[model samples]
Target: MDTTQRALAVGVGAALLQALMLIAFAWPAANIAPRDLPIAVTGPQADLVVGQLAERSPGAFDVSRPADEAAARAAIEDRDVYGAIVTGDGPPRVLIASAASPAVAQQLTQIGQQLSGGPAARVDDVVAADSDDPRGTAFGAMVLPLALSGIAAGVLLGLLIPTIGGKALGLATFGVVGGLLSMEVIQGWMSLVPGPYLVLAAVAGLVSFAVSGAVVGLSAAIGRAGIGIAALTMLLVGNPFSAATSAPELLPKPWGAIGQLLPPGAAASLLRSVAFFDGAGASGPLAVLVIWAVAALTLLGVGALRTRPANEPATAAPIPVTTG
Candidate 1:
């Protein structure tokens, strides 16, 4: 057994250990269901109703007693509550914002009705969603744009670092534009991704532009290694850690906490808010995106300054006097 072989074995073992750890962290995090989504209760027996609901489905609904029907509706509208129950003389009525994921709203409605002894329940859907958007589609709406942006960023990083020619830049621009246009056309014309075409396009463009700028800047600063770091941050950590596919409350605490800080996660959340959630509680995600964009731009500027030739003579050299 040679020393080199032993060292190679150790390296492989270490790599395997790291991979396992990452997988362990991400796997369970992905599967855990989001529990205890806020739900407002308003009725003569709101407390009793909430208690019954909790008994039926433990840890599923986090019920809050609102002052009145208006407050309950407002909570749903503000995204403070996923849905609400308002009891009346005949049967309990469920109020769900149209902006919430249809699946969740439906589930809540069914649960509310069931808890109230299967009586007919009136449903009030505020903040109506797009007709074409289907139930459980919110996650897809959020992630698609972020994924496209990441791809664009990777390509841009490749092109910008090597000091590509003006033609290349033109080509790159065309590609980005074409890709985004294609996405819009497919989503709108073909109905590939439900909802407003213009809105989707706008979100996608913003995400792509921000990601590309960040990648270019990072690459400029640290060369090839910068791209690797960017990938680790944006793609590896950001996408999986993002609570798009599953809500943050479902994810393990670590991933949920870290996910909010990343670009894809932030963008996805904002998109979901705008699309399915009716722009409910969107300020936080928007702030995250803004911060990321500003930080990346600043980094890009620093990288540019660092790359400038420090000792280059500014003035044209005076031709040496010819000694005749």
Candidate 2:
């Protein structure tokens, strides 16, 4: 096929792949169920509570023991634990980090109410989502748009910068600038996401760098096909599986875990950590971003080496002047 034909084919294939993934993932959003979702437990009956929960719903939760409600609350704030169940007192109280995942908090609250087969359990929200956007939909909003922005940045860099070094520098510059701008828009104007300004900007920059690096590397390595591959993997497969609007546990099976490994998912998680969890749970996803940046940059170097023409000779040295 000619260049145009191949481009059309790629576009169609990418669209089809993304469309199918959208259907597959969106349907499960409403069907979300916790699979080994982590929660903390405190009080003397912690053991009994864990055992009963296991019996009642196998694999629904992964329970841990905290020293007390204070520790449990600390865990929630740090994003180490999503919610907690405090027993031993009259009518067990469920502690939630609604900021981390409202759906998770709600589910735990419902479970607490059902535990005693009595009225609703007392729900405590240790960290709540932004009041303006209580459901924290901004995370979901950011996912696709961020991915697109990454692609646009990559395309512009590739077109404007002819050298690998230039492209890399451009990517970094775009990341930093775009990140700050995003902070102004999301945090300043909307106040939809709340976090330390510098922290949010830094995380956003890193995320943009990761995405742009992947695109640039792919474009260099596989030509146009690489860009398509990167886009499909990042935007299509990564977005919905990210579970930005809900806890990662709510996503189905491996896809949930899989999302956290990708750029879009890692970025969303990192942003969440900065925005609400006091920078908790940031390390793992931050490491993931670093790995992507290193690997993609390396790939870009390799592709550059491979694509250089064999016949292109080294520049001839300048001849020495004979006359003074």
Candidate 3:
């Protein structure tokens, strides 16, 4: 076979290998489930109740028998457990930490009520959410800002890369423009996701800026590797486990537990608090994002400094000697 034919065959094989690897990584990441989330059970019949819940739910819940209600509340407050169930005279009460995810709390309430054989279950939101917030909507707003910011960072990186500057810039521009346009289409035409337009726009802008800055900063620091890492961290790992499409409570255990830490997950929760939940309990996620953005920018700045040309004075020519 000709050398050209061999080269083509090798290139095709490499491309196929890359495609398969991506698919393999994405598949399991998408379907992660929580295995052993810490949970507390309290009250007179706590033992029986915990057992029932464990037996009935099986892999869905792991029950922990806390000493008392105060202990259970403390567990939740400290983020030791995802939730707690408290049994009372009339019906079982499920106490949830609102800071975790309001939707999950509500679902637990419903589940407790069903278990109690027609008696209405009482819900005590130990960490109360802002009253104005709606359920199942926090994830989108929280994720929007970070996702946009990451995109911006990626674009900047592309522009600065020595060989791919023009192409990277073009792609980055398209992503930013396309992302904004998508928001418009979603709000105006589809109406599938609802919120205040002005607020949504603001969120979109902030997220896009932050994310773009991060991507650019990363690329500046490490060149091509930085871009790949940013994409992996921000887009691939961050988006699927984002908790936007499904609240953490609704998701299986594994995905639910780590969702809060991912960039998209953090931003989505914060946005949900602002838009649907009255911004009652979003400080944690907001803080996480601020730290990430600041850190990335710092790295970018240092990288830029290192790339600057060094200052050096030109040496003067030696005095010419007279010929004998």
The runs of at least 3 residues in candidate 1 whose Cα sits more than 4 Å from the true structure, single-residue gaps closed, are: 1-30, 53-62, 97-99, 106-110, 119-130, 138-145, 158-183, 192-200, 276-278, 310-324
lDDT (0-100) at residue 132 of candidate 3? Answer: 40
RMSD of each: 5.1, 4.1, 6.9
Greater lDDT among 1 and 3 belongs to 1
Task: Show where candidate 3 strays beyond 4 Å.
Answer: 1-44, 56-86, 89-110, 117-149, 160-206, 247-259, 275-281, 310-324
- 203 Cα displacement, candidate 2 (Å): 0.6
Candidate 3 structure, TM-score to reference? 0.59
Error of 3 at 279 (Å): 4.9
Would you list the rank order by TM-score, best first? 2, 1, 3
Best candidate, TM-score:
2
* CA-lDDT, candidates in order: 0.66, 0.83, 0.63
- Steric overlap count per candidate: 1, 0, 29
What residue runs in model 2 are displaced by over 4 Å at the alpha carbon? 1-15, 159-161, 310-324
Candidate 1 achieves a global lDDT of 0.66
Q: Encode model 3's per-residue lDDT on 56-125: one tens digit a residue.
A: 7776666777888899987776656667888768677788755466556665777778877766777777
Clashes of 2: 0
Please give, for residues 1-324, the per-residue lDDT of candidate 2 as tens digits: 999999999999989977888786676686699998999999988888899899988998888898999999988888878999998868788898778887787889889989867887788889998898877666578777777898778767765677777888888898899889988888899888887998898888888888888888888776777777887778667777877878778888888899999988888888888888888899999999999889878977877786677436989999988986
